[model samples]
Target: MYAQVNATNSNSYIERYKAILLQHPEFTPFSWGSNTIYIDTEYTLYDVDKNGIPELIVKEDRSKYYIYSFNGTDVISSDVCYWSYDECLYEYEGNGIAIHDGGMGNMRIENVSLYSMVNNKLVWSGELMSTEECSSFDELYSFLDSLTPINDFLPITDYSHLSN
Candidate 1:
């Protein structure tokens, strides 16, 4: 299941695909893709670059596969290719894509780096990490607060399980 949030209106909207939550708005499920990929012994959903957008980390036993995306749209693919060899138990690093705005538009990356694409080619952009590196809960909150661009950040609400 996934979650959906529409901020187009003055009053932001949020909804969940399917799932039961305890009693908090934070427990509300978000709309997500129904498609899944099998990797290792467990199905893993990765945010790719820790951004809000996520992609299914399809794992096929011992191999790694990615649900490719282009401009935030999942590419229609049915073939699985050898992305990398396994080095961990159930997690495969460098096996997903992330969208980045390279001072122009959005670009995809397998790994978050200090550099990103430029002019349709990979080039040095800038370090991804800021001075506020995530170290503690307070730091995380501070980093989150530091995000200037409002739309880039998602609203995290704590709502009661009470229905409308």
Candidate 2:
């Protein structure tokens, strides 16, 4: 009943999201090269569900992403990702849809799937296409190209210090 008791409006969720980010264990300054993701304000948030309240996307570690959303009763999180030695990428489509595509190398576990936040729960809404499903990169790219291209995402930024 977190959302029921606490959910008032979209802005409230954003504020709550900020508070959770501050207390997040993996909510640290993260960057691999030129891209840096920060947890500061609304500019960096995404409304994957189109519920007016945007969800927080956190890249916790090497290959794990924690997506948080409000279920109209309380805030909840989707399962964190687990990438192999080579993998990292994600983007959102229109209507609260998200797609993640990554994986390469010998031990790599190729994966691509669509996700959506419904009723405060993050669920896989599309079929998962892995290396087993797609024979080669060409096949994978073709599949990806066929997907809806909302490509909604904010540029990665570094404002971690601002939260401090």
Candidate 3:
């Protein structure tokens, strides 16, 4: 499920849809295609920028995804992609977090970006592929495997606790 800060209490507002979260004081009304969007609970929490804190990645729908990074008191949200199918694969390299969009089922690589905390915000520093270059999924996977990570952020050792 997706989560957001409750804005009033230390408790976080977690739910499957933005519309439901909107019921809480922390969220404001935002227009979208529907309020019935379901978020996959299987999320990943990793330090994308090696800043001693981890960012939360969750799938909002089949094509929409978000990455949230905490900065002391509040959470910063990053729109990872609107055309992504399934979940984004994250690799903790010596530099930063390498995110690959494509790998589920027959999905081909659509985009690859490296995210790191810049000025307290998660920003894309590099792009592996911006256009449709690979014709097959295997080719895309091979290309993704060959890419060199740009961010040299350290990896978080304990990530299991974040899921619980």
**Clashes in model 3: which pairs?**
1-41, 94-152, 95-151, 95-152, 95-153, 96-151
Report backbone clashes per prediction.
Answer: 10, 4, 6
Q: Which stretches of candidate 3 lie over 4 Å from their true place?
A: 1-42, 102-109, 129-137, 145-160
TM-score of each: 0.25, 0.59, 0.52
lDDT of 3 by residue, 46-139 (tens): 6677766666654443445456666555566665545454444556564466667544455533677666667645566887664366566567
Query: What lDDT score goes with residue 64 in model 2?
Result: 55
- Scored by CA lDDT, what does every candidate get? 0.28, 0.56, 0.50
Cα-based RMSD of candidate 1: 15.5
Clashing pairs in 2: 3-73, 3-74, 4-73, 48-96
The best candidate by lDDT is 2
The ten-residue window of minimal lDDT in model 1 covers 15-24
Better of 1 and 3 by TM-score: 3
